[model samples]
Target: MSTVHKAATVSTGEDRKPDVILDYNKTKGGVDCLDQMVAAYTCKRKSNRWPMVVFSNMLDVSALNAFVLWSGINPAWNAGKTFRRRIFLEELGKALVSPLIQRRKSVPRGAASLRMLNQIRGQPSSESIPSTSTATPPTKRKRCHVCTSNRKKTSTVCPKCREYICKEHSVTITTCHKCM
Candidate 1:
């Protein structure tokens, strides 16, 4: 039996490279453009916690991609490249925060509907709605742990130490006393 071997054909000059190389070059440019845009405003913070930093960087990249897509869709309203990333980021932050702030301000319709339904059923409402006041009075007023002043109204009780602390002595808006 005779063994036959097929020789590989080599392309000379212009045809030496594959057609996919051209497509790859074109696509690579787009990837480089997006990477450049993302790199322009990357979040770099020195912290012991890795999760927050990673999350923030992902958010930054997402924002950059959104901006690019928005600009592509609305050519007339497109901003110049010279536009500051800080301003864009600030606007993005405001856009995200505005809805939450509005949500907090407006009372949920479900609560009102539930109250009406309870009234129709002749059942007393479980909780009484308080009047809208700029200063929220404490549900259960107690003596301030820090100051030990019994006169001042304590708004929150510390969860950690289980001590009542007045608004003045509270470190954080949510957490009271030394637990903050």
Candidate 2:
């Protein structure tokens, strides 16, 4: 029982609403707007842990709120764009993870990962990613100097060996601070 209501009141008429409900309904507009944004796009993941769930929810709401504040301040920014929130969220996610991606020293194996890395960096998928940031990576794939098998093609050079090496022959090593 609510302190304000004192006791549950039986509705004599179908049109009657409780005083508590009326007070709650006053903020329904903002709640509905936030709900719509949350439903449309969210960072939520499937999990039973309450802390992760709460953090994900907070992230979703914060992103939407940030979008609102940004748009309100920059009147001309992304003008007349119908799906501006989606675009904003996408860019924000990329910007957040970009530094980490750039700092990664390991060259992940597999074509899919390479393609994803290239796409994230706004480069063509066919191009090679920097392995250790020693020298300017060659535009063309060179024959692996260390490859014993039928000469494997590679663009990455080994930082440890100081020689042209394919994914098969190279070990992941961290680069210097200046290189990073």
Name the candidate that leads on lDDT.
2
Query: lDDT per prediction?
Result: 0.63, 0.71
Q: Residues 30-69, candidate 2: write the lDDT tens digits.
A: 8998888797999899999999999999999999989989
TM-score of 1: 0.42
Model 2 clash tally, residue pairs: 0
Q: Per-residue alpha-carbon lDDT of model 1 for 9-67, expressed as tens digits?
A: 33455767544554465578877887787777777677779898888778877998787
- Candidate 2 wrong stretches, greater than 4 Å: 1-19, 105-180
